[model samples]
Each structure stands twice: as C-alpha cells, then as structure tokens.
Target: MQKTPKKDKEVINVIIQEYQKNDLPWYIGYSGGKDSSSMLKLVFNALKRIEYFHKPITVLYCDTGVENPIVTTYVYETFEKLKKECKQLNIPLLFTILKPKLEDRFFVKVIGRGYPTPTNIFRWCTDKLRINPVKELIDKDVKAVILLGVRSSESEQRDRTISKHKTDNEYYLKQSGSSSNIIFSPIINHALEDVWLTLRYNELPKSIDFNQIRMIYKDAESECPVYRESKGSSCGNSRFGCWTCTVVRKDKSMGNMIENGYSELKELFEFRNWIAEFRDNIKYRCSYRRNGAKGLGPITLEGRKIILDKLLKTEQLSGLNLIPQEEINRIYELWEIDEINVNYQEKRLTTTCIKHG
Candidate 1:
C-alpha cells in the first residue's frame, strides 16, 4: 500500500461531515467496479470513525442478469461479506440487489418480443435493464441523496456535464426531471491515478478484496452497469458490461479476458460476436418499424425463434442459466400469438381467393 494523500483524507472527512449533518437517507450506488468499490471503502472507513454513527446507509446494486459470470459471483460474495461485517460492527448498512422484471430480461426482449440486440444508436437495453429497476428503489425515499463514484476525469464529456450541474459548494444537483433527488459525487475531482492510489493505500473493510478486481480486469478500467441518462456515450472500449453488448463494435474487455486464460468465457464471446453479426444482417430484421415506418425494427419472428434455439444450446454448453424458466414460458406465449395471427391471415386470403374464382 502506498502513502495516503492529504486531499484524499480531506475528501473522506467531508463525506463524514455531510453524513453527520443530514437526516436524509443516503443511498450509495455500488456496481462492484473499481470506482464504486473505492467509494464504498471510503464510506465504510468514515462510518467506523464516527463514534456513535447509527444512520442507515443503503447500498444498491443493479444486476442486469447478462453480466459476466465472474462479475456476478464477485458481487454476490462481496455483498454477503459486507452484511456479515456490518452485523459484527453493529453498523446500519443494508445492501440490496436490484434486478429487471422478468419480462424485461435480455432473453425475453430478444426472443419473446423480437427486439433486436442493442446497438450504439438504437441502444434500448440500458433504460429497461439497468436504470428503471434502480430508479424505482431510489424513488421510494424522496429525500435520498445518491452517492456516485463518477469522476470528472473519466471523460471530457463527463467533466463538462459535472461542471455544468455542480452547486457552488461542488455537490452535483440532479437534473430537472429528477430534481427531487440530489447527487453527491465525492470523487468528481479525483484523477484516475488518485482513484487507484486511494483504493490501494486505504484500509478497506474486510468484506471487500480490492485485489480480486485487479486480478479480473488485469489493467483494464471497468465500471459497473450504472445507467447514465445523459446521451454522453456508450461503453465502447470499456471492459465491463453485459457480454452481449454490441455498442462497442468489439468487446475488447471480454476478448482480453479470454486471451488472459479465462477460456470459459470463449463461448460467451463467440455468442456475443455472433449476435452482433446477425444484428447487422438485413435478412434477420423486419420490413417495418413498430410504428409502421420503413426503418429497422425488431427481429422477425423466424429470427427470434432461431436465436432462442441457439441461445438455449449455448446455455447447455456453458452450464449456466442464461434464460430463466419464466422467460421461456413467456416466449412460448408470444409464439402462440404469432402463430394464431399468421393462421388468421392465411384463412382470410383463402376465402377471398374462393370468392374471386
């Protein structure tokens, strides 16, 4: 561990002071990524320092269901460890895992509803899969201040957005629509190097093993599946997200993992690339948009069925429950509806031909 900087200490102190001053419930958005993990460590250390800290701190994690298998395991294990630690320390820390509704699941959308895999321009996955579930939880507490690990140094666009909405004292105010909720980006000013330094030098809770993150990523910078409402940009080159994400043109992160001896992920990487390739092929798409316009629409019924069959085969090979039973049931229901509609159209055409003859 390296030496802790004075500025880092001051940032932690400010977080403590802010927590002490407010009776408003605090919700920390934890994504099991480097930034969120660092934020959580700082918050835990701060709580330990406060002599009579009894305020409840809620940690929210959004699970997209399609996340890398290794990441899913890490998240579950870390949360369980944190809960045990909190119990021993008598800290009021609650960790909750948020998940998308059954109907909104990745397989359900792609196979049941025939929605195409998300792309850079038509990326519809984020809002339904990542944002809404977490937002529903946050909305429950009207006075909640969301703690984020977003650093301005991450991107130029992010920096400009942060500077635009920040308060005089540096607290970032949530934009117009979400005016009820405030954002506390404690590490906004911290550089990328500062972030890693703080994570290394600080005494983190036993529940968190920062080294695990380093081992998994192997020099790749990663972020949890936090939904950014701003149309800033996609996780193009970033190594952390749903394995099926096609917004980046290439999943460099997963490719790197496979090259780094995670051979188990090779099948998933292949499936992901296959889906991306299929998505670009006009043969797999419908003739019209859902709104009746002549544009790219959901995958055709035949396309959906073929993809579903392939995905199930992949699931068997990987020995992972990629699609749940509920989603399978829903897909059958959708297929039945499509079948009935097609039958009705055929019968109508037959009757019309007989009358004309």
Candidate 2:
C-alpha cells in the first residue's frame, strides 16, 4: 500500500464531521467505479473513526439490467462481500441494489414497445433506467442527504453545475429536481490521483478489491453518470450501462474490453452495432406514429420480431441471459395488442369504403 496523503486524510475528516452533523439518513450513489469506490472508502474510514452511528448509511447501486454483464457480476459479488464484511466489522451500512420498474426496463421499451434504442435526442434510458428508481427510494424518506462521487474537474459543464448549485458550505450542493434531498460530495476537491490514493490506502471495509477494479479499468473505461440531475448533463461515455446502448456512433468502451481479452463481449458488441444500423432502416420503422399521426414512429412489429430473434440468438451464442422470461411474455402480449389494433383499423377502413361505394 502506498503512503496516505494529507489531502485524503483531510477529506476523511470532513466526511466524519458532516456525517456527525445530522441525524438524516445518508444515501451514497455507487457505480462500482473508481471515483465512487474512492468516495466510499473515505466514508468507511470516517465511519470507523466515530464511536456511535447516528443514522443509517445506505449505499445504492443501480442495476439497469442492461449493464455490462462482466461489471454486473463484479458488482453483485462485491455487494455480497460487502454485506458479510460490514456485518463482521459492526458497521451499520446497508447495501441496496435498485432496479428500474419492469415496464421501464430497456428491453421492455425497445423490444416490447417497439421503441427505438436511445439516441442523443431520445435518450429516454437515463431517467427510467438509472435516476427514477433511486429517486423513488430516496423520496420515501421525509428528507435525506445523497453522497455522490462527483468532481468539478471531470468536465466544464460539471464545473458550471457545481458552481450553480453551490451552497454556503463548499462540500454540499442543491439537489436538482428535489427540495427534500441534498447532495454531498466528499471528494469534491479530489483530483484523479487523489481518488486512486483513497481507494488504495484505505484498509477498512475489506470487501472492496481495488486491484480487480483497476483490472476492469485497464480493459474498459470510466462510468457514465448514474444520475442525470440536470437537463443538459452528459453521460460521459458510460461503459457500465446497457450492453445494447447505441447512444454513441460506436461503443468504443466495449470494443476496448473485447480487444483487451474480454472475448465474451464480441457477440454483444456485434448485436449492438447491428441494432444501431437496423434502427435507422426505414423499412423496419412504422410509417405512422403510435397515436395515428403521419410521421415516423417506432420499429414495426416485423422489425421487433427480427430484433428479438437476433437477441435470443446472441444470448444463446454468448451464453448470457440477456432478456428475462417475464420480459418475453410481456413482449408477446404487446405484439398481440398491436396486431389486434391493426386488424380493427383495417376492418373499419374496409367498411367505410363499402358504404361509400
């Protein structure tokens, strides 16, 4: 282990002070990435220093179902280890895996509803998949504090956002879209190196394996912002998101992982590329909107069927259960409903023509 820097110590002290300041339950947004991991490490150290636990500290991990399988497995395993270790250490930390509602799942919207995969303009994924689940849980509390791994130095837009939401205290910021919740970033002042130092040097919580996380980083890149607090906030080339994500022209992150020895990603990568190209093909799209407007709409029923077949084939080839059986049942139900609607419309049109003639 490397030497503990004075700056990391200062951050941990600050965390301890803030944690003791209120009885409010704390929610830490964890993406299982380096930044969040480091922030969590600091939190662990702070908790260790205190004699009494004032309130609950819940670590929230959002599993969108579409997350990279490799990362998903890592996070799940880590959670198991964390639960056991925290129990042994007598740390009153709670670990929760939050998930989007079934209807809001990625495959449900895309394959079941025939909606296209998310793009820059129609990035309907972020709120439904990542943000809403967390918000739903947090809002259940009358008021709470949310700790995030956000740093101003990550981007200019982020810097501006931090500046805009600046509270009297430098460590806290106004939580966007909610008056009941406040945002606290313990590592607000930490640079990239500082983040790594926090993770590597912290000895508590014996659950986290920094080297394993580092190995993942060596293959794939950084996380996409888990929560979109602001309207114009970017996703930051998110690697941990849905394997089927097509928000970017190409998923370079997955590609890098594949090249770096995660060969299992090849089929998923091919499928993602195929879906992106297939999405824009007019033949596969409805000529009219779902509301009967004369404009381009969702993928046609035939297109949806083709995509599902391809997805199943990919799942079989990759040996990964990409879609749940529940989702498949829902998709079939939706297809039946859509077909009934189409037949009803055709019959009505035929009757009108006969009457006019």
Candidate 3:
C-alpha cells in the first residue's frame, strides 16, 4: 500500500536526501506510540526499499522511567525485534534509553520532597520525563538528525506549534544548539487517516501490538499532560504520564483500558480515583506543610490529603501495596530537613531577641 502521501512526497524526498547524506547521523525517535510507530514504519520502509537509506539509522526510544506497562513492554519488544530484523536485512538498528537520574521519578519528588502531583501550570513532570529524555536521545549522535513522527494535522495547537519552527526549506527540521544536533519530522504533512490506512493495509510485526491500545483513543478521549493552549478539554488521551494524575478527574484512557478487561491493572486505577477524592481532606494533608505554606510562595502547593493514616487505610481497602519502606523513609528525611530549617530559624530568632534585650 502506497501510503506515501501525495502532498508530503516532497517532504519525504527531502528526508530521503538527508538520509542519503554520507556523514550525518540519522536518529529516528520512536515512542512506541501511534505517531512514532507510523514514523517508524515509514522510515523503516523507505530505508529498506532504497539502497541509500540502508545507511545506519538509529531508532532511539527514551524510556521515561514511568510509562504504561503495555507501552514499556512494547518499547522493549519493538527495539529488540527491530534490531533482529535489521540484522537479517543488514541494517544497523540503534536503540537508546533516556531516563532521569534517581532523584527524578515520582516517588523521589512527590513522596520524597513533598512536591504535589504536577498541575497544568507547573508541569514539572514533562521536563523531567518527556523533554529531557528526548534531548538525551538527540545528544547521542555528534551530527544527529532526530526524526519525529509529528504531524501538523495532529492538533490545531500542534500545527501552530510546528509552524513557528518552520524554515523556508524544511517542513519539520529544526536546529539544535549544536550544528550536529538536528530534529526532523518527515510525516508532518501526513493526515491521520493516512496513518491508519497505512497500518490497516500493512501487517505490523507480531512483536508490536497496536490493537490493544487503540481503544484509549477510539472514543475521542484526549487528556494530554503537555501544556495545551486551548481552554477546551485536552484533545489527546491515553497518555503515558503519572497514573496518579489528579488533573483530569475522569481519565477516559485509563477507564477505557480498565473497561477493556485489563483487570490486573484495575486496582491502580481505583487507588488513583481514591487519591483524587481525598486530595482536599485537611485531616489527611498536613496542616503545616514542610515549608509551612508560606515559603512556597502565596499558593500553597503543600497539601495532599494523602496522609500516612489515610495511606494505611487505602492500602487495606484496595489490597494494593505502595512501595514499601521507600515512601516512609522519604517522608522522614523531608521532615528532618524541615525540622532543621525550623530550628535554625528559632535559633536566629533567639539571638535576635537576646541582642535586642
């Protein structure tokens, strides 16, 4: 099936020219998500069919420490399968993983430092998880060209976002800080239907399963963690962010996955729902947060109705186990940090009082 879009043929040609270049490192970024999957198929097919594309193409996937179980599995399987397949075809398949240092996961910050679950305005999650990981992948090659499967038609906001980066010549090519670091989005012009059409006609490897995750997006359920410019509800769902995301109360993607017979993962969803309900409970949330609500600026991002007592209750009720010893240990460390700071302030006050007296 010639899913090569008619309008985007020129973009493909340019991408092909870039690939044909002798010196540049072609690092195609894959998220194991649909958009990236389509990009993978296109680039893989293009490379496989043409001798010039046979040059080394690094298929980089950044594992954001916390991804959907299915997504994680898919990524690993896809990387391995692609590598073997490339070996058979004599093409070098390069896969890279970019995860944050130990201090960047949900537990380290949320359970450790008492930072609340990220809100829309302050999405501390994305820079650590999504953007940072992608940057790491790009940083691998000295003269790297990062191929992303970002399409203009994905969203109005996405279209506008990509437009700003457009140079007169390239559709989705942008310069990174280094002259060697270049990002390319070849499928920027392809339509959604075109992507699906390509998938429907071609048989993806048994290692890759798109059928399972399709339901998350099947019903117009989109809650993107990425900052959206629109006031209306976010137009992307089944995203692979925190499971404890309290931002979107009704997570259509999680709901879809659960309702679709992922019974094993049902408890996590239930736990998330309970956390959202109990978020406002003052009893569970500390009255005086570690920073005392004042230090964290005017807005008190200090409270979460997930106290130790409530967590015990939640564990009993859900029959779910939180990470043992870790959260408790983290809370204790933070409390100590807070206590030391409080004591220093007290000592300063006492000296000042004595000085005045």
| Strongest candidate by TM-score | 2
- Point out where model 1 deviates above 4 Å: 1-4, 222-237, 342-357
Question: Model 2 — TM-score against the truth?
Answer: 0.93
Candidate 1 lDDT over residue span 93-163, tens digit each = 89999999988889888888777788767788887888779878888886678888888788776777776
Candidate 1: C-alpha lDDT: 0.76
Arranged by lDDT with the best first, the candidates are: 2, 1, 3
Q: lDDT: which is higher, 2 or 3? A: 2
- Descending-TM-score candidate ranking: 2, 1, 3
The lDDT leader among the candidates is 2
Off by over 4 Å in 3: 1-14, 52-55, 140-143, 175-180, 203-240, 277-357
Candidate 2 residue-wise lDDT at 276: 93
Query: Candidate 1 has which clashing residue pairs, if any?
Result: none
**CA error at residue 216 for candidate 2, angstroms:** 0.6
Predicted structure 1, TM vs. truth: 0.91
lDDT, residue 153, candidate 3? 84
lDDT tens digits by residue: candidate 3, 49-112:
4664445777766555445555566678767877777778755556676666446665456655
Collision count for each candidate, in order: 0, 0, 3
